[model samples]
Target: MRNLRLTLAWAAALLVAVSPLVNAQTTSEKNLKSDKKAAMSKETLPRPKVIIFDVNETLLDLAPLKSSVGKALNGREDLLPLWFSTMVHYSLVETLSDDYHSFGEIGTAALMMVAETQGIELSYDDAKTAIVTPLRSLPPHADVIEALKALKADGYKIVSLTNSSSVGVETQFKNAGLTEFFEKRYSVDSVKKFKPHPETYKMALADLGVKPEEALMVAAHAWDIAGADNVGLQTAFVARPGKTLYPNADKPDYVVNDLSELVKHLAATKTAQADTESDKTLAEQLAAQAAKSAKRFPESVRKVYAEGIETVRATQIEESAKQVGDAAIDAELTNWNGETVKLSELWSEGPVVLMWYRGGWCPYCNIQLRAMQQNLDKIENAGARLVVLTPELPEKAKETAATNNLDIVALHDNGSAVARKYGILFKLPAAIVPSYRDKLKLPEYNGNDAMELPLSATYVIDKSGTITYAFLDADYKKRAEPADVIEAVKAAAK
Candidate 1:
């Protein structure tokens, strides 16, 4: 009996010690399974041929609309988030109830709800006008246009699929100057459902004549990504500020902070698929050529070049200047003949190519001017005028034009005032000032004591006053190539 008791005691002790180990093993197995599931969930997918972009906050910026709403609400912009969330919620509610409401109407209703909750009086008509009008004129988010152009250049059929009404999307695209980027604009109203609904995504796929797996949906909203992923479409989630992917939804195939990163991802896939070494973008080719040319310069000259390149790299002029969608600022200046000319008058003829040059002294400027002169025929043929602006006085400007044998109109910006307005004027760096003052005599040529010069930036302005192409760099040697300028003009004319 004592042996039996000893054995039982031992068994009981063993059980106590091993119980925790068993529990730990079970927990470990569960964790392993969970991790494996997550890994599978995030498995990368193949690229898609067609890319569908989401409008409203995805591509178009809504901050201005928020401001307008805030003005209507006694300067309470904090209420915008609640209003937008409420609108999205009711949009889904309407979709689930087999009902249909235009996004604009939903926005108005949401605004009204917010006003009521805040105990503020807001008329329905005022709400509608405030919300809907801004919606129609919203500008695209930064990095949207360039990314879309990159994707399109890579042969992807880009389209916009939104919950907005057809007319609403049309006006939005038109006002945003994004109509040309999209091959087609789709509205969820056609399917009588809002996004995050499988039907809405499926409808877009059907309309594009693409299978769900063959198309990718790019959106700033997690719900949009979730809905597209649920319907078997590839998804790219653009995590705009304050946007997050839904934890419960399937992981998107790609996640980026903005459209520019998405474009880089897609462009890499395209570059991988190219069969030959010659299939490269113009920008890439130019960069390669510039690198090759840099090797030939003497060390002193190369140092200047390096400094210029570094300065340009440091200054994000391209981002700060009037970009593709911005209206070109009208400026008044005198032509080389001392006749006052306005930029608006130049645009009245056709598309205008506005260029800035340093002065008659800079070899780089002369090279660029002569190069542009060679392409003047092509520019004029494309229904565009090539107008050059220089800080040089009228006689010096005339000298530069005659020296290059250029027939293009040369304007004299006497005080660099017009250049400053375009965000292209900068004071000469201290290192370069001695050369300009002693060797170049820039003050005499430009007739300016300020020692300021405009960056040799070029812009292609369309007839609608929108700047379609802008090449602004602090490095004067990196002026826009004539061929690229011609291509830009052609695009503007189109």
Candidate 2:
């Protein structure tokens, strides 16, 4: 009996000793899994894409090229256009064929071709120095500094990219007074290849510690945009006058005519980011509710409005337009024509088309009015009355209407008081005011000399004065097309 009890105690001691090892193994496994999960959590987090600006045509103005090339070719400015065209074309070819060449090489080739055609004395080295040196000294576009400052203020890490070597890039930035505007400058020198070559872009991004998806390449060249887009980098095309966009091919995520437009787009994108987060939160709430009551309802309907909130917020277009409609706008005073017309009075019978014009002095406004005049019949047929509103004095407005041959009613909304109420009026920048006053010859606002109304905005207001459709573009050169107006009118009719 003594031996049996001793053996039993030994067995219990043995079990106790082995049990700790098992528990230790289990705890170690649990810790390993937790560490793995933490590592994965970091890996899954998304990083912000680096926004890269192409230094040449995007931020810098190349108008100096005309005179520079004219001198290089000995008084033939006509050869200027062809040189730039061929330079861009061959650059793309070099990249597309998986071959890399410096921008200087392409520029030399283009200049030689132009020299041969024009019978000018030019050598490869001369062309290279002229093109590359000018690039190092070109001025930033008028809107560049303000726009860049705004982007930097908005917490976006700005980068400058160029086919030039890092040395060349630094010289360019220093000359343009833009050195402080960029966090970093990426030159193709490290990769020893020009852009459009995936290696060049990839290496630059890798150096920045960012992935291609988290980067945006801004350029004025369509091929540059296409190449950037191909490699998974978002693209912004700055449509400078000498440069154009590829409308059909791999379109850029954003197209802006100038740097200011890009800044505005970025601001809008920031707003959209907030909107998207709100939408995601709403979706999460709905999903949680759906999970709670799985058996009571079918999956699809339950998924849509599963929460206590019965209404699913959808983007309502014409419905929202009809609900608020547009408010009746009127001038506080009448013109020399003795017409004191309430804006709503015109729309009561049919849809009233409203156009805001700056003045006759504005070439952009003139072009827009001409476009509207051309589509007068279309406007009339759409059961809409066309009215042109201007902050200009009555006489100036009349002169503008006569010059444009507009049959539409002209209403004078002096000082843009009505415009201020509608949230569209803004003071002209100090820089633009002097240029507009001296160059465009526009008179000052009645109340405020420093302020002026915008170029033009067209709106389709329903009979109830609610704006069914509105076109508000800050750019003067662009206007709502006749087709868009017709569509808005038809949409309102339905």
Tell me the lDDT of candidate 2. Answer: 0.66
| lDDT (Cα atoms) of all candidates against the true structure | 0.77, 0.66
| Model 1 TM-score, 2 decimals | 0.48
Off by over 4 Å in 2: 1-48, 92-101, 282-494
Q: Which tens-of-lDDT digit does each residue in 179-242 have in candidate 2? A: 9989899887777656666666777676665545457788988877866765667678988886
Question: Which residue segments of model 1 deviate by more than 4 Å?
Answer: 1-44, 270-494
Which residue pairs clash in candidate 2? Answer: 49-214, 325-466, 325-467, 326-465, 326-466, 326-467
Top-TM-score candidate index: 1
Candidate with best lDDT: 1
lDDT per residue (tens digit) for residues 298-417 in model 1: 468668757855775577765677778888999888786668889898887789999998886665676567667766788999999988888888887776665444677688887988
TM-score, cand. 2 vs. native: 0.47
